[model samples]
Target: MSKKTVFKTASLTFLLTLIFSGIAFGQNWQTDFQKSLQTAKAEDKPIILVFSGSDWCAPCMKLENEIWSSDEFKNYSAGHFVLYKADFPRKKKNQPDTEQVKANKELAEKYNQKGFFPLVVVLDENGKVLGETGYKKLSPDEYIKHLETFVN
Candidate 1:
């Protein structure tokens, strides 16, 4: 190919790659539970509420890397679930605002009474609990299937 033709082809390829990769990894995890509830109601989607100790919990980190951050989960979850993360980070810098902390605690009281680090609770739009789970040794596809069981 000519130099100009090659440059055009490379630029087009790079742009397409950027676009598709953004779609693949665009998992919008809402930090505010109330906002996520509103989105769930409006979208008619189930809520995936995750309780995690991001800084101090090993299992939580594993779950984050293995499932939540996976392309399959991100892409699928975007269209199907309203994601809410109730993080209890131990690091000083990672700590959220007091109000957020309080909200997370309240959510824990109702859904994660036992204080599991990597608890996953699926709920309906109106905030009814569908099911609860924890970190499992499974692939992204398998994990998605497991979460779907709660909604179905």
Candidate 2:
């Protein structure tokens, strides 16, 4: 093989690896709030706790589809925040572990007593509440801009 062809193949392999790894990493959301808090403090990043009803809530599904799953949000969040999900799914297959369910319920008592379906709570590294938001009819960039106001 020629030098240029070998170099091109290597570069293509590296790019494909990065793209696939990014996609896998972007879907990672912590189930443990304490672990997320520790990571947030260590990384000097904020915590974004999403209280979602993944199986039943339309708004939660919309939030996931429209904002959280977007590449823009994933990229920004990967650098800037410790992501956590306290999902309260109605379906049995979608239910989390028992300990996770207990922890999520405890969190709900403190942050979401009224039980909002798609509540998003932003907190500082020390777990101080920075802001709360939910299901806005904005695109990913617009939603990120709105979050930036609270986080910054």
Best by lDDT: 1
lDDT of each: 0.94, 0.90
Q: Across residues 29-121, which tens digit of lDDT does each residue of candidate 2 receive?
A: 898888888999999988888999998999999999999999888888888888998999999998888999999999999889999989999
- For each of the candidates, give the backbone clash count: 0, 0
TM-score of each: 0.86, 0.87
Which residue runs of candidate 2 sit more than 4 Å off their true CA positions?
2-16, 23-27
* Clash pairs detected, candidate 2: none
